[model samples]
Target: MNKKYVLFAILPFALSACQSFPTHLKKNEAMIVETQSPDLLQTLSDYTWIYQSSEKLPPIVLDLDAQKRIFIKTGCNNLMGAWQFDGKQINTAPLAATQMLCPPEFMAQEHTAFQFFNQAQLNASINISNPVHPLLTLENKAGQKITFKGEIKPEAKYKSTGEVVFLEVSPNKKPCPTDNTQQCLQVKQVKYDKQGIQTQIDQSWQVLPVEIQGYQHNTKQSKIIRVKRFNTKPQTATPEYAYIYDMTIEEEVAPQK
Candidate 1:
């Protein structure tokens, strides 16, 4: 028996074992690195996400601000909080929300979502493997997962902050100031308190004939709605304020023609 031959036989086994362990470990490390990249955060920041887990509830919308703060809309109420991402792990601060009363179903959905986000060691992953439709996934310690589909928010596309306000739209469409032949919805600004009480209402009405981005007016009724107003650059000839309908507050029959 030669010592050199025995050493070579054992050497192959040691090398095989050494390689197997790291290869297994590298696969996991790569998976973690893939999700923790800053690009993932940038992808998330580019669009507002709509929660797709529940059909009965209104889609939840999220906007990440410049300061790393998150603004959330759970269909009926708004919430604000700080969020941070550290190597595939997602963490959130205590969230503050408006005290709006909503249906029991929506309230329950909101609470469940809040708990999911506050989980200490939640994991986040994005599926951009498909370009046309990107998905965001968040998984809690209990293995429960919430998924969201992304939609470009106005601020992301327009490159400006939108002023969020509420407007009461008149039932009757009055003659447009610019073009009398075309009738318009007489809109007035309305304000609400933290408790969702109507704090102030504008007495004067202004004619708005153009289509608002997120608002759909029903000719059969008048409505009080929340809207986002974006300001255009002064250099452009476009109208100063661009309005998008957010949500309807009150609905009533149209006034007699």
Candidate 2:
């Protein structure tokens, strides 16, 4: 047997073994793929990242929308910015923040977040060990880290962008139509056109069967509110649609009768 021929034959086997076993990859880093799926943004945008500093403190909310816009809530004022993920890192542009004075504890977290995210490009990692609950982490050059838990966005889970509906809520509650034992919201559907001008409204108020998320009507005031209407999952929900409060369009204290 020729020595050179034996060495050349063994080289191919060694290369194949190396290719089969990529020892360079760390177990924790396996999911941070170099070639991410084409719909990476869609996957990321589906979830909202939340940072809960403590059970007593309010959680910081970070949302990534389809327009490449980042919406952040820091317990006081909202922050808006742009963001991009380049395989190994997440880059956040300098944010445009609303200037509002908040409590010291709230502002302290806000300051920390500003230092972490404002105009910083960070190394990023995601742990999808459990699909039901995902984790996203960002690290700076100084080895400082911020970890956020992920929750599926309402729009993504519902599979619809949701319809915007206007509702006028009466200050008084009435007996529910379905359950006379329970009280219900007195509401009238208000209609609008593409220009957002009022087109029509229900003549009589109706007892609402479902509760509106994020709405707590004051007993002394009537309110006209904007809400996103989404269809509930069939067979699993009592109401066919769920309304989430978007904003209060109008409010007036009801005169004592």
Candidate 3:
């Protein structure tokens, strides 16, 4: 085994998980941006707005009441901060947030709101006429933008389905690994259901696993299986045709030039 391969295997554990929010923006001078619709902005200012990401968790709600009090739900715990809105500027000073540690997922949501609040150069528009849906348009310091169509919905119920998948797994090249024999393998996807109803998994979509191992065998018995390398020519198959079942386990021989 090459010394380079041994060092490469140890590199995965070296990654550190840390998150920081930027809180250095100055607030000496007042700033405001004109909105296309004034009534929309007013309707937005009146109610507490919640932001829910695609993550499978509870929503993060931010309540901006009168008297400059800002209360936010960090998925698990509530955090309080000082906020002042002059004209259209919704300025939130650095929060004296609570030190309660929820799951890491909730912490990520808190960080997202912190960054969005800190970088608001202008508040464009907010329309909340429909109680179920609201529209918020925000602009950052660089004049780049994003539009969020907010909706309040109930949590979705999920279930487990017993279906197998044929999956092809490969380590990313460019930074090649030391294992020359072990490259990539395809496997069948495990089935899942929602609320006892079978869910549809997109065709050709792969579930990425952590390990570089190709064929997954039962631990009760030992088996030897050959697997293809990552850089092999990928065969493209259309959804209209039949689904390929066999995972290529050997080097595909090239034709004569």
Candidate 4:
């Protein structure tokens, strides 16, 4: 795949920070005396990490262990995989995947995801100070860094309003395949016209910046592909609704290999 296309497809978890070391580190000698080393595998087994990928409208949490067991919940689908954790490395292979087929944009994401875990090296660690979150660093053989801040949650609820939203397609500007045609990113704006209540909804899409077939092609063009059904609705106190809409941003840029 073209590097640009590959990048577009590969990024899902692409975006954290603070410098304070844990208190134990401050008292290194005391910590060493009191803290016994925990087995890495045992410490991370069955732990979950929140993941944000380009394909899904919302982030997801991934759960896996040494038993070759795995599970994940994207905003739209529940997925499964098989995992392996040798003393020094971890590997994951997706098992049977469902065919709900999210939007075209999300479809690209699904493909990207399969490509990601099919064969990748993963490093897992914990935040001793905050057990609720686990840190994961995924890297290719080249030692390039693909890291993120992930949260552990047993369940994720989804909310959706019967509505349409806009998304920004990246790689801001480029030349179209045809003469005199230009390709650029587009931002979508969605709202409930009935009440005139508007919400700027962020979305996922498989964008194609190509020229129109056979016309003068005066205007540079880009394709807009809607990915999945997202909960663009504002948060509420009650969870009575089946789905909720959320508009959030996750940029795509990682340490290069």
Global lDDT of each candidate: 0.67, 0.73, 0.42, 0.43
* Sliding window of 10 residues with minimal summed lDDT for model 1: 1-10
User: Would you list the rank order by lDDT, best first?
Assistant: 2, 1, 4, 3
Per-residue lDDT of candidate 3, residues 1-257 (tens digit): 00111011111121122112135433333223223434443454455565567669777676554434556666765555555444555556545455668789878877766666542444556666765667666666666554555542211001111122323232222222445445323233322243322233234533332233334433232121222223112254521111222232222222333
| Candidate 2 C-alpha lDDT tens digits along 52-150 | 988877899888776556777888766667666666666666676768899998888888877787766678787889766688887987899888899
Q: For residues 1-257, write the lDDT of model 1, one tens digit per residue.
A: 00111111111112221122212124455446546675776666877878855686788877654445666777766666655566666555556666779898888877876776542455888888775458878788889887888876677666777888888887667888789988878888877676666777788988885658867768878778778887766468875777877667677676666
List candidate 4 stretches off by more than 4 Å. Answer: 1-38, 54-56, 76-78, 123-129, 142-144, 148-257
lDDT of 4 by residue, 14-49 (tens): 110111223323334423422443355544553556
Sort by TM-score, best first: what order? 2, 1, 4, 3
Steric collisions counted per model: 0, 0, 9, 18
- List runs of model 2 lying over 4 Å from the truth: 1-35, 38-40, 192-199, 233-239
RMSD of model 2 against the true structure: 19.0
Q: Candidate 2: lDDT over CA atoms?
A: 0.73
Q: Estimate each model's TM-score.
A: 0.61, 0.73, 0.38, 0.39
State candidate 1's TM-score. Answer: 0.61
Best by lDDT: 2
